[model samples]
Target: MKGRTFKHAMAAHCESGTLTALLNHAGLKISEPMVFGISGGIFFGYFESKKFPFPTFVVRSRPGQIRTALARRIGVKFAERRFRNPADGEKELDRLLSLQIPAACQTDFFYMNYLPGHVRVHINVHFVVVVEKRGEAYIISDCYSPELASLNRDSLMKARFAGGSFAPKGFLFYPVSVPEAIDFRKAVWKGIRSASFYMVKLPMPFLGVKGIRMFAQKVVDWPRLARDTEHLSHEIMKINIFLEDQGTGGAGFRFMYATFLREASELLNDRDLLEMSKRIMEIGDRWREISLFAARIGKRRDLGPDRLRELSGLIHERADAEEIFFKELLAMSKKKK
Candidate 1:
């Protein structure tokens, strides 16, 4: 542990980035997009509950699914553990660091002291790798940070044990083994097929492309939920942050998944996938346009009904495009299989 080095690199999202880093550290050279796509990371879900101060939407699959799907698709094994007692979690983390094992910990984003206060929130599913321990502080490799950061033992403990939805409960994982070789072709096709199925075939009305449409339909009603105009404006602006700045690599993971398709096309030598990659990239661009529009109108405090309807139209348009795009993708995957 003393002599070994853990390379730290910034990534678009926390879960995929941490997985890529751990896999790379374990001698498997893979890109973040490849990891994300192979894990079926792109998704959409609209949620309204008391758990949040305002209604929100998610642009990716559930946390921990990335690791689980990767293990199933590829022959990778991870050593994972969770603790009911916070003290035991800290002890196990220290033991892993002592053995030179860089452990990935799921903790609340709000407790990461290195981030700017404005950017921090109460998300309990954020992932960070503890590269090493130094006295009372641990060296952290957070995906969002440009450089390695440090977190005190007390802060780390609180983050790991944070109570709420998706509570981490001191969860941690690290790669234990990876196959000497990987079947990129089969993996890529399976990943793409699964993503398309989730988007177009899932039964849940509040998930996938249907969720996007629901968001469009329900957004006009948001004015009733807000405390005032400023609150409404702030929530609208958060759409931009969630889609771009909060780690979708831009366009709510559309851009990253597009990158994966391009890489998969080159690797598998499939011209159709290459063409699809271009199309998804265009779709991602449209999503970016929506985010920008939301940000601008929100900043201007233009929350009138007409403006809201225009925003809803923009979202619905994206949903239409995605429905067609994913169905085509599903057909392409079936043909390739």
Candidate 2:
């Protein structure tokens, strides 16, 4: 029963048993891939800052008997998942010792929410660790669930101030009352609240539900849609054209349009949509062929715009019709669900 309020948390660092000073001490010995974070939501930063490139490893630390409660209800993705299993807890604990304090490490910070109860604080912290092989930065990313995101009725944009202040509930900590490491985490996540992961740095089209899971959902249903082959012909043709029309630099309006629609397609299930989807597939196939041809002709530079316009014409011509069709498809999908 350590104090549960932020005011009590102010003197948190005074506890030498906490992870903050431990991480600071660890930093004195620069080393390789490692992790040092609380269990309840403070992110670790090694390779890059949150706003830049690098990945965040979410850690859930515990030094208590009731740690059994965490065996399953809590889970995560990314290298952070390295800590997911029951067997690796001791190993992760050791690795934490070897980790160096991220260059940006701060003695102060803030965050949100909390998991109540117990002897040792049960909190989760997010960390930014770089993937390097033989000493070179490899990849960067963020771990978040859309389901978790959708729970936000607040529609909070990832803001500079978003995770900045120590949350009203104070920082998320690992395994209860056991000297909380909540201070540093609250300080850190707040620092990088508006930052995007490395994957986001690339000039990607950023289509909806930006994740492999979301992408997979669209991909999985594709096979089911394939059974309607004949109806797919024109549909595919239109789709290819639309994809190309997505615009000039392979960025902006058309890119967003095509990417967004591909995701939007997932929301519908109308006969017309199925019909249109079939055409979209056609165009997707044809575009590959056309792109190949353009490469051969050295006319690829013009290919993008030409294709975008040709494809856009279909949707443009049947704008209202397609909207109604897709809306019906959406309604249909809801009914099926």
Best by TM-score: 1
Give the Cα-based TM-score of candidate 2 against the true structure: 0.21
Query: Estimated TM-score per prediction?
Result: 0.98, 0.21
In model 2, the Cα lDDT at residue 288 comes to 46
| Residue-level lDDT tens digits of model 1 in 1-337 | 2346899999999999999999999889999999999988899999999988999999999999999999889889999999999989999999999988999999999999999999999999999999999999999999999999999989999999999999999999998889988888888889999999999999898899999999999999999999999999999999999999998999999999999999999999999988999999999999999999999999999999999999999999999999999999999989886
Where model 2 places Cα greater than 4 Å from the true spot, the runs are 1-130, 139-315, 318-321
Evaluated at residue 269, the lDDT of candidate 2 is: 28
- For candidate 2, write residues 1-337 as lDDT tens digits: 1121111111111111223222322222111111111121111111213542211111111222111222111221112222223235323422332342111111111111111122112122222111111212212111111111111111111110233322111111222222222233232122112111211222332221122122222322322444353433323333233224211112111222233234334433234434544543443344345434323323323323344344333323332332343344345434442
C-alpha RMSD of candidate 2:
21.8
Worst 10 residues of 1 by lDDT: 1-10
Candidate 2 displacement at residue 104 in angstroms: 19
lDDT of each: 0.94, 0.24
